[model samples]
Target: MPLSEQEQRLLDEMERHLLHNDADVVSAPSGDRTLSYRNLVYGALLLLAGVGALVAGVILGDVWGIVVGVIGFAAMLAGVMFAVTPVRRATPVTPREATSAKRQDSASFMDRMNDRWDRRQDGR
Candidate 1:
């Protein structure tokens, strides 16, 4: 069955609201840290080397092979950790500044959402 006019209108409004809010979420700051391209590249290189070592170890087989494989595994683990870990900002964000900044950003957003909810509940 097709949606009634009121239902369609509500759906449209919901879509608009979702799109607007989604833009905010997408653009929101990720905090005082970021990933480095240099780190990523180095990590990838390390990971590749680890894989090669692992394969070489497998082919060699024996006590030494086991040691090489373990080392390779550790290298791979380190590479992954290095790649994903975010670097801290040079200047640290003060707790008060962080809280105030976050509150200022989110307060308006929450208020808007609350107003919308109120309007919606009131059948406006």
Candidate 2:
């Protein structure tokens, strides 16, 4: 359900107050839990290599074949582990904070302009 304008305003105000009072609330870091696409691809490659090695090992029936098969299986297991691990990312900067910064800069510029105007008027 969509929030009404008054509810939205209240939420915004509460957020501003909370952010002002709590630095952790504003700057808290977040973590990304999804595995990256690159990691997925790597995992797939490892699995395929392991399967191929195992198949070749069965067909060749040699010591080197068994060794290669074991290595490939280990690689595939490592890839699976990597793919399952959660990735960490920092919390995103809020649009409200950015807008506030821009407004402050504009206000400062306007104050300077007003000061200059007052100085000129006083001189005249």
Candidate 3:
């Protein structure tokens, strides 16, 4: 059955309240995890170049080549990391989830203090 008018109104009010209170959470990026194909290809090419440079440096025992190889390796790492990194993760957050967590933390803290007070009162 559909929600009653009062229920609907309550829900709408709750939504507005949640949005107002947790506007930052709602606007925060949720990590879109799509990879850019172009970037991935470029990353792969860079990795390959780095590997080749490192191998050539090791085989020839050239210090400058080794330095260049390390730089290439760094570039490859950057490219690969950029390609793999998520733009944003899609997170569907509700006010209840946020508040519930906070409430739980606060409740735990209060419970601990209350328990201590009770123990002291009971002299045990």
Please report the candidate that would top lDDT against the real structure.
Answer: 1
Candidate 2 lDDT tens digits, 10-31 = 5665565555557566554343
Taking the tens digit of each residue's C-alpha lDDT, what string does model 3 give over 1-124?
A: 9999977865655565555568676555343444557767877787777777777767766788778778777876876786675453355446566665554455545576589799999999
Candidate 2 collision pairs? none
Candidate 1 on 1-124: residue-level lDDT in tens?
Answer: 9999978865755554454457555324357876778889989899998998898789889998999998998889889888877776777545464345444455555686699899999999
The root-mean-square deviation over C-alpha atoms between each candidate and the true structure, in angstroms, is 9.7, 16.7, 12.7
Per-candidate local distance difference test: 0.74, 0.67, 0.66
* Model 1 pairs in collision: none
Arrange candidates by lDDT, highest first: which order? 1, 2, 3
Which runs in model 1 stand beyond 4 Å of their true positions? 1-29, 90-124
By TM-score, rank the candidates, best first.
1, 2, 3
List the pairs of residues colliding in candidate 3. Answer: 30-88, 30-89, 30-90, 31-88, 31-89, 32-88, 32-89
For all predicted structures, in order, the TM-scores are 0.51, 0.44, 0.40
The lDDT of model 3 is 0.66
Local lDDT at 101 for model 2 = 56
Evaluation by lDDT, superior candidate among 1 and 3:
1
